[model samples]
Target: MTERQQQRSPSSGAGAAPAPPPGDADAESGPTVLGFAPDTAEDDETVEPVADGTAARVAVGSDRLAYVRRPDLVGGLLLLLAGVADAASVWLPWDRDGDVSGLSLVVRAVDAAPEGIAELGRTGLWQPAAVAAGGVVLLVLGLLLLRPARGHRVSGVLALGVALAVAAAVVGRLVDVGWDARSFGPGAWCAVAVAGLGALGALKAVLTAPRVTTVPAERLLVG
Candidate 1:
């Protein structure tokens, strides 16, 4: 061969590099950014995941948990009724004052001179006010009991205190005003009944534990 041809021979420095081995693709590809595996053009198949319906079940279970259950519902409804009855008691005639209803008591108290907490108490409408306040609180508590995740223990305890206060207020009023009770109106009886019912509801709420969320194992796993 001539000198120029000899220079281009296979053993010469200018000879093209030997072809790389076929199985060493890993060596040919460098590490990707963010430590991700490098994507290869050969990976064109789309993987269709199996539809297990687990996610749907999990969602349903969570949604159900948002509402109060049957036992709580009944109790809550009773409490609501109790609150309404007691509140109405404040409007109806509790005792006979020349055939006047207790509803007039507030107006009369506002106009009367200070009379301390003895006969009618310093605040003439203390008992009625208590009944009204307690009833309102009970009503709100009852409604709260109908919802989920309200910390039932705390709400129940609060309701219990309110119920007891109302009961005491009603009893004290009866004792104070009973001597003059020529004719007790339906309001008086209604107040007592509602207070009793409210107390029961409060006690029930205090004693009961909240329901735990239940979901299928598969749903939990999916979630």
Candidate 2:
């Protein structure tokens, strides 16, 4: 070849190839770099976050029981009101007559002798005393119903006790001549019936009540 042709001969050696691009040091073993193997990188496993104090495990059953029944609470409150009314009758001082204000109504009802039964209205401290004792018992029982504890059996027993006490009071009232003219005075009958129904309600609440369980914290979260 001529000397000028040889000088511009593509500056090529006999058969040497171009050099390859530099390889990533962490590409194969570590997470892939951006734009490379993205699909495979996403599939890589990772640990989930956990609560600080509790373990990762949870119980689904207990979560359902946390909700309380409104009807049960209503029944319990009704019983409590009945107890208060019964207690008020002991100190209402109705035996004196003309004490019919809202506050004194409860007292008058207990000692009210009416016309015929004035002699029977003599409380001798025993009758009014017995009623007050029963009232205290009923109040305690009603409060127990409000608690989260299992009170089905306890409530039923308390209700029964209230019913019995009211019945005895009514019987005592019937023998005396008072505002109530009949052998069984109006007040006596009402007290008996109210206490009996209250007892039944408490017993029913206990018998039909469903079991409640605590819910786990994990179940509280939305999916």
Candidate 3:
């Protein structure tokens, strides 16, 4: 065979297939064992990473109780004292005439009437009992506020409402019998002062209570 012809022979590799383009190399090659591709769903829903130290600071479950403040402590004590004093006032002299006590009023009404319990409202003597009950409710709410909890604001509000209601009842009694100091017995004066002070303490507690929030653990740590 001629030299040129020999060089051009197909068996002699005169012409070989052109190399595959870089983009098509994979297709030409057999199936490749690719490295792991992370889940796209997780990638799409990615959260910003938090620091390890910050993650450790997050509180959980009941451990997330709100921080108590100085005002809460002080106000709670005041309300407790006011509650005790107000409740005790029910046994003291309520009127100038006959020195009728709250308990005495109930007893006399029961002794004189067939429906003594029902007569309480009609004679307006139920005010003292109602005030006493209100004082008790204030005491409970005050006790709750004394502890660190998420319900501080709610307790404070309840306390304030009860205190205000008691104060209003005391004022109503004073108005009914004329506001003269001589018209008030020790019990009446005590009720008035205790109600006023209880209301003020409740107001302070409500205003100073911290707002409680529920957030993700990560967010709590970040904050």
Taken over the whole model, the C-alpha lDDT of each candidate is 0.67, 0.53, 0.67
For candidate 1, what is the TM-score? Answer: 0.57
Flag regions of model 1 displaced more than 4 Å. 1-71, 96-98, 108-124, 178-183, 213-223
- The predictions' CA RMSDs to the true structure, in order, are 9.2, 12.6, 8.1
Worst 10 residues of 2 by lDDT: 40-49
Estimate the overall C-alpha local distance difference test score of candidate 3. Answer: 0.67
Task: Give a tens-digit lDDT track for model 3, residues 1-223.
Answer: 6888766746446477766699876664654446443443332133344656332333233334443343367778878887777766778887766578766754664554666756765666666766777777877777876876543567767777888788877876877677766877777776776787688778777777466554433333323
What does the lDDT read for residue 59 in candidate 3? 29
How high is the lDDT of residue 183 in model 2?
38
Error of 2 at 87 (Å): 3.4
Predicted structure 2, TM vs. truth: 0.45
The total number of steric clashes, by the backbone 3 Å criterion, in model 2 comes to 11
Report the lDDT of model 2 for residue 77: 76
Tens digits of lDDT, candidate 1, 126-148: 66666766788889989988886
